[model samples]
Target: MLKNSLDCIEETGKGDISIWLTRGNEEDNFNYLNIMDTAKGIYPKQAEKIFESFYSDRKGGTGVGLAYCKMLMKTAGGDIYCKGKFNQFAHFILKFPKID
Candidate 1:
């Protein structure tokens, strides 16, 4: 994820990747991390598509990064999703299920 954000900065001359982590709430299903980047953000329509394997716009980009991340999170009983605005920023939130 950092690489993706860094690449965006490298390509666009905009550099801002904010990573925030939080503890899961015992009484509620919670998100533990947020990765927001000021890179060339995704359009609302592309948000879902970004998680698809082999989907990429950049040259030589295999497009497996986010897809892999989604799979990994699911396997660990968590969920991953992206929220972003076109030409603005992309925010990735990772939610982990509550544990006893």
Candidate 2:
């Protein structure tokens, strides 16, 4: 995902990729990591579809990256999601639930 973000910003001369990690609220019992990039953002529909297997819009892209991440998170009893708007930003939130 970081590599993809870096590639997305290359055409514009400059852009930003930010990552933040935080302990989620006690009620949630999760830790959170956010990866946000200022680049050519994705449409709402596209964002949802990106996690599907074999979904790729990039040349030479195997398209398994995001889908694999989702699978790993689920296996760990966590979750992942993406949200963004066109020409604005792309944000991916990963939720890691705390073990008992």
Candidate 3:
């Protein structure tokens, strides 16, 4: 996920990236890591599709990075999501449950 954010920043050539960590409610029992980047973001249609395997819009991009990350997160009882707009910004949220 960090790599993806770095790539987005590199692609934009001029933007900022911010990270936020927060704790979820007691019912949720999860910790959230939000990575937001001020870059050329993706379209709404691409938001969910970006997590699909082998889906990349960039040259020489295999698109496996995000898919793999999602798989790993799920395996660890977590999940990942993305939200953003074209030429605006991209925000990725990763949620992991707290360990007892």
Cα lDDT of all candidates, in order? 0.87, 0.90, 0.88
What residue pairs clash in candidate 1, if any at all? none
Cα TM-score of candidate 2? 0.92
- lDDT by residue (1-100, candidate 3, tens digit) is 6777788789778778899999998788899999988877778789989999999998899999999989999999999999999888888999998998
Colliding pairs, model 3:
none
* Candidate 3 Cα errors over 4 Å, as ranges: none
Clashing pairs in 2: none
TM-score to true structure, per model = 0.87, 0.92, 0.92
Better of 1 and 2 by lDDT: 2
TM-score of 1: 0.87
Question: Each prediction's Cα RMSD?
Answer: 1.8, 1.3, 1.2
Instruction: Name the regions of candidate 2 deviating beyond 4 angstroms.
Output: none
- How many residue pairs collide in each prediction? 0, 0, 0
lDDT of model 1, residue 50? 87
Q: Write the per-residue lDDT of candidate 2 for residues 1-37, one digit (tens) a residue.
A: 8998998899665669999998977788999999999
Model 1 C-alpha lDDT per residue in residues 15-48, reported as the tens digit of each score: 6899998886666676578999987998988998
